[model samples]
Target: MKELFPLKQVMGFAFSIFFTLLALAVYFFNMSFTIGMTVLLVTAFLQAGLQLVVFMHAGETEDKGAIYTNIYYALVIALVTVFGTLLCMIWGYV
Candidate 1:
């Protein structure tokens, strides 16, 4: 069936490959470091999410909500720790 074929998944894979190639092009061509890094980061994050959701079916199980909640909490904590360090150390806000 078409579901088994998963055209959407194919498209997502193609897009991932395209973004990877684009990143390589930026690197090989010696483009602006800031721009290249930004693009690479964006694409890398997006591809990771796509792979998680599509291929891994991260939210398909009954515990998906719990999983996502845990992820969110972890992200919040990470952000706080990172920002706190930057604030205290770099910004001299202690």
Candidate 2:
């Protein structure tokens, strides 16, 4: 039956493998450092998001809005904190 397929888990596993290969390719294929790093970062984040959504089921519940809001807030706080530190440390703006 369809219920026996475990479709979501399977897809998540497949995507995770694909992303792993993508990151490895970026690292081993002699691409420019900047380009390779950019590709790896994008793919890594996308893969993490996919894992969260599919495996953790972050979007499946009634509190999905709250979950997303929390995630957004965390990201904003992280960005601000990192930029503030960098601004002070690197730019001598302390």
Candidate 3:
């Protein structure tokens, strides 16, 4: 019954837990702001990608190309919006 055990999902879940704990370590260890933020961002992106591919099955469809394209577009838009706001409000570069 190995084929019916959902191994991939289990592994993904375990990896998600590991990443979560790693992020938490940054907080508990009292890392510098830059280091903590870097670690958190890296773990967050990795977990998000893992969830998308493993849990959400982003690559298991016939239209996977379209799905990934949409994801890329959304990422670009989000980055632009965030950086634009930072540039105007925080960086004083309006």
Candidate 4:
């Protein structure tokens, strides 16, 4: 029975639940825009990282370093794409 339970996965599940609840609270409560956005952003990033490391087992394999590097590259590209779009379309970069 003990061997059946994956402790790390359980912990990850709990943490994911916690982050979800926190996000819900931010949505339900009448928080200031800046505060709400900040909290939501922080929780969102944490949840994503937790999901990757725990559920996805991102660091368990022998090629973990390469995997992490690829993830980082993807993240950088995503950020750049988002910000560039915003700058050009929303912020009026010409």
Question: Which stretch of 10 consecutive residues in model 1 shows the poorest summed lDDT?
Answer: 45-54
- Model 1 residue runs over 4 Å out of place are 81-94
Q: Model 2: residues >4 Å from true position, as ranges? A: none
The top-ranked prediction according to TM-score is 3
Q: Largest lDDT belongs to which candidate?
A: 3
True-vs-predicted CA distance for residue 38, candidate 1, Å: 1.0
lDDT of each: 0.84, 0.91, 0.97, 0.95
- Candidate order by lDDT, decreasing, is 3, 4, 2, 1
lDDT tens digits by residue: candidate 1, 2-85: 668988778878987887887788878887889888988788778777787778887899999988888788879988999999
Model 2 lDDT-worst window of ten = 22-31
Error of 3 at 4 (Å): 0.8
For each candidate, how many residue pairs have backbone atoms clashing (under 3 Å)? 0, 0, 0, 0
Estimate, for each residue in 1-94, the C-alpha lDDT of model 4 and write its tens digit.
Answer: 9999899999999999999999889878978999999989999999999999999999999999999999999999999999999999999997
Candidate ranking (TM-score, best to worst): 3, 4, 2, 1
| Superposed model 4: Cα runs more than 4 Å off | 1-4
TM-score of candidate 1 on Cα atoms, chains taken together: 0.70
Task: Tell me which residue pairs clash in candidate 1.
Answer: none
Q: Write model 3 residue lDDT over 1-94, tens digit each, in one string.
A: 8899999999999999999999999979999999999999999999999999999999999999999999999999999999999999999996
